[model samples]
Target: MLAPVDDVVAWGESLDHLLECKTGQLVFENFLRTEYSEENLLFWLASEDYKKITSESEMKAVAKRIYAEFVEVDAPRQINIDCVTRGEISKNLSQPGPNCFDRAQRLIYGLMENDCYPRFLKSDIYQALLEQQ
Candidate 1:
């Protein structure tokens, strides 16, 4: 079973605030197209249609729907961030991707390379932070 994402859940508003920033918009876009799952919000929020994902493929299929909505509504440019929590992380990790961990790892690295957190100390810390992504 997955643990709760309440911390990250609580962080959603903060995340939304972060996403509202210019850079955040780009990050949200990249997140929409990449490995992140919109179903995280759906599952946690538990809307009528969201309760239907029962399998890995089902999750990904639903995720595509969420992804479409996300692209149109969340991010208009090409940036994204990992707003998922451990539980949501577990759900996505449960499904198959082209090396989900590795992909997210590299995604973080790429984001850093592109200077996502321009004020951050350095790119090395970004790679170290990839373990969380």
Candidate 2:
């Protein structure tokens, strides 16, 4: 279903390229949705947004929101991460900062790149898009 011409180009290039392009990222997000793994992309996007927050109050607010939604145990969209990383995030949450989620963010990024991205490339949706091109 990801038929945007510009995005199609990057989709066929590589996962790294696709992740870097907004259009391609959306397509990938949709693909992840079909697999019930949209949280991976959502976590990555939230991290990017978190880095852009300049206000202290805003940064703490977004940090807590992201942690509660994606990093905390039993979180609605909790991402799979090691206990150490999760523990670090939990400790940081007590004094939430702009960089509190950095470790967890990196772990999620790697999970997507190494796990989901490969499956996405081989998915029927991706193949269909290639055929269309």
Candidate 3:
């Protein structure tokens, strides 16, 4: 549903990363699965470097920057075959904490071992990209 000329143009030109209807539904399911897992919301909240912001504007800005810098450029396939095969996406997308990165690394390694697409991230570049905005 998201494949089209307009989507391509919009993605190139805009920082907005709002999910389409179908994608939103899928994300909602993933979120639910994560929330009910052994490691719940508080687990993620505890490990966050910035646990709380002083202002609503700051919170929105952080979300905006994260969406623009990480989600946009990496085009990280949030929903993937590993997510499906392991039944992880249905129950792991919401496992809150620094462990999210660790999970991604594990998935990336698995994909590489299987000769599939590799996902990688450089923290320095991510910092610079967020800073520039």
Q: Model 3 misses residue 70 by how many Å? A: 9.2
Candidate 3 residue-wise lDDT, 5-88, digit = tens: 453333223222212323422332244344332122112222243335445555455534433332232333232224343343
Ranking by TM-score: 2, 1, 3
Best by lDDT: 2
Cα lDDT of model 2 by residue, 1-133, tens digit:
5466767767666777887788778878988999999998999889988888888888878888998899888999989999999999888866777788888888988898889998988988777887787
> Each candidate's TM vs. the true structure?
0.24, 0.89, 0.22
The whole-model lDDT of each prediction reads 0.38, 0.85, 0.32
RMSD of 1: 14.2
Please tell me which predicted candidate would have the highest TM-score against the true structure. 2
- RMSD per candidate (Å) reads 14.2, 1.8, 16.1
After superposition, candidate 2 runs with Cα above 4 Å error: 1-6
Q: Model 3, 19: alpha-carbon shift in Å?
A: 30
- Kindly list the per-residue Cα lDDT of model 1 for residues 1-133, writing each as its tens digit: 1213342223234544433344443443344334344333222222224444566676566645444433223533212546552234345534634333333344444553344333232333323333344
- The superposed Cα distance between candidate 2 and the true structure at residue 61, in angstroms, equals 0.5
Q: How close is candidate 1 to the true structure, as a TM-score?
A: 0.24
**Higher-scoring candidate on lDDT, 2 or 3:** 2
